[model samples]
Target: MKRSHSNTGANPDVRVRMRRLRWTTFSLVAASYMLAFFHRMAPAAIASDLQLAFDASATALGALAATYFYVYTLMQIPTGILADTLGPRRIVTLGGAIAGVGSLLFGYAVTMTEASIGRMLIGLGVSVAFIALLKINAAWFHDRHFGTMVGLTLVLGNIGSVMAAAPLAWVLQFTTWNTVFIVLGGVSFALAVLTWLFVRDHPGEAGLPSLREMDGHEAHPPHEGHWFEGLMTVLRNRYTWPIFWMNLGIGGSFIAFAGLWAVPYLSDVYGMERVAATQHTSLMLAGFAIGAFSVGVLSDRLGRRRPALISTAFVHLLCWLPLVFALPMSLAMSYSLFLLMGLSAGSFTLSWACVKEVNPHALSGMATSVVNTGVFLGTGILQPLVGWTLDRAGTAQGAAAQYRLGILIFFFCVVVGFVGSLRVRETYCRYIS
Candidate 1:
């Protein structure tokens, strides 16, 4: 990988210079990831409009929403390889361009088939962003701070999710959803150009001293393992499987409920207006954003993953119990529980850090991507499955019953995640440093 040099002169205050570089890098990477989140999730924000426009059923809507994940799941390994080999800078630049084009296509799409194609393109384009950002974090930050940094990045990037909720709804009131995507697509293209021009692969390549070097620590070389060998290593590890399954369950359930159905579920079942439902959904994302940052900081501060993971899972399990009963509850109560769900569910963002810690340094990309695969794959399958169950149930009231069943299923998934979390060897006590 090649690096850029802003200046070659020896600095009087090397620490200050390094700090500035780190922040700049963090900001750029976070922005790119935010755009990826925007593209990945924008569909859900406008699901109601899509169903009306296309005159599609709930199952069809779910399938369309899951289209992004379908391609994202398939690209995980390839993205991992690209992140490792080409480095995050170039891969993310390319990804942004692809995503930008896809968004434009989606904006222009008039039919469900066209929309599906656009969604797939958007998925393929943005699929590399998260893993690539993780690769950059591993390159730039100290190992001890890795989990917290990843969590912080997720916190900032998920502002896209927040925007995808009420803000998007507000935007739609002024213009069509298609126009919003068109504008977003153009912004994505510009960001890609900036990434290509400004982002460097690593500190050493940029002719600046690496933090490890500055701190009198040795930097590890890239692992020499082949892709298949790296894959096998990740698969064979007992610790890795637990995190993988944990992500599959926790992330899957979170994405299914919060990302895909929360708004529609509120509107259709709770009898809230679309705008109110979108706002409530935004509140859920706001809770997630806060939780993601908090969990990361606390995990780093406490140096423990299991307690955070287990506690959050338990909270998430409790949140679902109320929804499953579906007794006559105030809208305020439902929103509060949903916020709790988001906060509890956000703990899974720690899974990326966990995956990075358990795998060898050489295979961090592969390990992270593999664990993430379970997340997207599970969402892709479950979103439509939930919708299908509701469709089969017939009436709106019946659909609410079906959704309750889905929540119960999600509760079971949280249990699965809790068990998987326990299976993993606790890494927080043994700092990556």
Candidate 2:
């Protein structure tokens, strides 16, 4: 009987092993997200080539780029629920497979309509990756480590964004854009297989103990509310709404500008060569990667979120004013200001911590997705809105004027985000363990 008890006790050690396994699984999941970022933003990297090839207008190109966000926004709420119900392992695997096919189709697309279809599929497939990873992290690691972990993951995944910029440009120089996407699609499919073979939903399910349990930390049992009720609870929570709006405001505009229009704004308006414009884009992405990782570490160390959130938003607000008011600046001045824009824009990195803090442990996936949905949805909507404004103010010489209007709109978003930040109660003071 003592030996039997000993064997049972050893099960916890196995569960502990699964915690390490979760990190491995998350790394692959993060890789898949990087692929999605690559494909999602690749059009921008090769925007000039795409425009010439397809005989596309700036507005048409903007719409094409925004297609991913449209499907991505629509998928978030449902994907959050699915992640909670079906678990990250399976959902991410399926997402990877679907996204892989989408990338392949996108590479093969002969018409704008076909390309749009591919973009939509990619959005649908990749939507689950981030939220699922967040769910796994929230479940597998201590809450105290959540923000830092997410930041690290984002930094890693953003390597794809870096690749999407200049490297993608360099690739396009040697190969047709279609071939680039075909290879990306195949890679995504392989990642799907890896995720399926290795990832487990939680440490317990893998015959291992939860991280908290192993560390003498008490585990919070997963929430068991009806999905609808859980969602409603998330919606009704006062804290959740503030973060959601904050993301919609600041995060939306940041993504719209940085992800889609920044290249065009630089090339067409600022008179930089296509290659130089792309390099500027790369610089912004690099800054974002650095800012996100740094903010995550600092937020965790200080044990406070509000100061970081407020400071970043205020800086972002200040940054937008320069871009809107100062037009046709020298290339050096524009690039310098854009670097600051990237740093300030990265303020939304704090939204993850804010979302995690306000919700029940089990609801982290849903809560984070809910806020993220706003960001992507805003991206989808604003891309076209900015494009339309630019089209209306049409002329190569007038591009800066139109861009100024778009930047003003972004300024409004930053102000609203600041207001939302004020409404949120500081959650860093609360202990999650």
Best by lDDT: 1
lDDT (0 to 1) per candidate: 0.80, 0.79
Measured against the true structure, the TM-scores of the candidates, in listed sequence, are: 0.94, 0.93
Worst 10 residues of 1 by lDDT: 1-10
* Candidate 1 deviant stretches above 4 angstroms: 1-13, 396-399, 429-433
Which tens-of-lDDT digit does each residue in 1-433 have in candidate 1? 3222333223546657666666776677678788777765666678878998889898999899899999999999889878877888888889889888888988999999988998888899889888988887887888878877888888887798888878888888889998988897898899899888777767766666665655555556667867788778888887888888888888887877777787777776788887888777777778888888788888888988878877887787777777677766797887787788788887788888888888887678888999999888888988888888778777746646767766677778777877787776678733352
